[model samples]
Target: MRIDKWLWYARVTKSRSLAQKLATGGHVRVNKDKISSASKTVKTGDVLTIALERRILVLKVVALGKRRGPYEEARLLYEDLSPPPPPKKHAEPAVAVRDAGAGRPTKRDRRKLDAWRNDT
Candidate 1:
């Protein structure tokens, strides 16, 4: 199956066109070989390396789906090999709060805010 079609059928991308763009844009690799065309064929057991926003996915194809299916069905198409994402760190809350009706900060207010930001 074409890489783009497989990606779409596997529910990796929202559409086949986006899969094509991703493949042609150099964000996809098949069996460690970079694929420059969306028409590249993929089969069972081929490892796919896909780079998505905020995370990289490594998947081993287990099946060639005939249609774009539900998430449950799609889950059976590939084996995820990517590591879990790191936990998020809690950040300190903002120290300053203005009234809802407050207008733009004055120069003096700006200075105070800058000083407060620097202190943290």
Candidate 2:
């Protein structure tokens, strides 16, 4: 079971091209080392660490798939080694503030400030 095929068969990615892209872009790792080749075979019990979106996934191969299949069948190809960690909360960027110690505003800043004052 090649890594890319397994990934597709497992429904981890939508298409083989996407899987190849991810692998080639150094997003997929085998035993912690990045693997770019899609043809790399993965055996049962092999651990894979994949980076998708914002989080990393750790999975263990449980079975080999000879062909791509339905979602239910594909899921049997691998076992999630560990449950994904909860998403970390991200604070929104703080609004920019003028530094009072700047002494004086630039011409543009003054105009903007005037507009803000008018709006208020």
Note the residue pairs that clash in candidate 2: none
Model 1 spans > 4 angstroms off:
94-120
Residue-level lDDT for 80 in candidate 1: 98
Q: Highest lDDT: give the candidate number.
A: 1
Best by TM-score: 1
Off by over 4 Å in 2: 87-120
Candidate 2 local lDDT, 7-92, one digit each (tens): 88888999999988888889988887789788888888889999899678889888988888998898887878767588889886
lDDT of 1 by residue, 1-120 (tens): 999999999999998899999999999999999999999999999999999998999999999987888999999999999989999998866768788899989999999999988997
Q: List the residue pairs that clash in candidate 1.
A: none
Q: Predicted candidate 2: what Cα RMSD to the true structure? A: 8.7
lDDT of 2: 0.84
